[model samples]
Target: MTFENAVLKLVSGQINRVSQPATLRTEEKAVAGEAASQTPFSEEALFEYHLYTLENPATLKNNQAKQISLMSADSVPIEKKLIYDSSRNEINSIFHQFQSV
Candidate 1:
């Protein structure tokens, strides 16, 4: 192969890093389909999410995280100004940190 062809193959290979899919039994198919919706999250986030689940679990699990975030947005109540204050404080802290350096 020419140098260009070899370099092209190497770059293409790096783009496809996902592993092969697992072959599952018929019974496992249902469970895998049901569980596939869960996203990668920190352990703390998972624990907190499950804690909420214990009180009231979502009817459907096979959906994106946005579904859950939206569910929380509808269910959980908070003062908008309070949220704004915390966000402002965070931005100000970042700004000060940069200014100091």
Candidate 2:
């Protein structure tokens, strides 16, 4: 199964399991209330959850660059240096896999 389908299946399965109880309720209102209280999941909400961003893109980039800089120290000077540079094309290539066809 695809990643999204797998995730939805896991989540929905959990919800389904939690929703059904072994003990039965006597009151009709109580049963109705319990059913009404259950949360309904939507595709939009699931997609948004997957796409949610915690930090600004610029801030994330800055933090990544800072982390890379922190890994290197002035005392540890080397003759040869290795750099990892990413271009727009590379970023697009990575992101393109998730885009809808």
Candidate 3:
């Protein structure tokens, strides 16, 4: 898959880095909801983790950080959960789940 005008962000164990801004272009299409007579076509933006090869080597200096974007999605469905274990402790944990279409 090729992405145009796509921004990338690198995330590792405790360190995060932002890659250079690029362009992304896709030919993928999505079908809209049922209409009275005709069906309309809409552009859907799909974001996924992908490996990208850099044209040139990038270097980072100490204490220097760069900002990069990983992915962007619209109208994403999310579920939030709160759990408490009386046997374990009195601490409550919060969990968030994101569903991708």
Error of 2 at 1 (Å): 3.3
TM-score for candidate 1, residues paired by index: 0.18
* Full candidate order by TM-score, most accurate first: 3, 1, 2
Which ranges in model 2 have alpha carbons more than 4 Å from their true place?
Answer: 5-26, 42-101
For residues 1-101, write the lDDT of model 3, one tens digit per residue: 33444333332332354975443223111211212113122222335433333323345555656443232345756789889889988658897765434
Q: Please name the candidate that would achieve the greatest lDDT relative to the true structure.
A: 3
Regions of candidate 1 where Cα sits further than 4 Å from its true position: 1-22, 41-101
Candidates ranked by lDDT, best first? 3, 1, 2
Residue 39 local lDDT, model 3? 19
Q: lDDT, candidate 3, residue 90? A: 64
lDDT of each: 0.30, 0.29, 0.42
Ten contiguous residues with the weakest lDDT in model 2? 92-101
TM-score of 3: 0.31
Error of 2 at 42 (Å): 6.6
**Between candidates 1 and 2, the lDDT winner:** 1
- Winning model by TM-score: 3
Q: Note the residue pairs that clash in candidate 1.
A: none
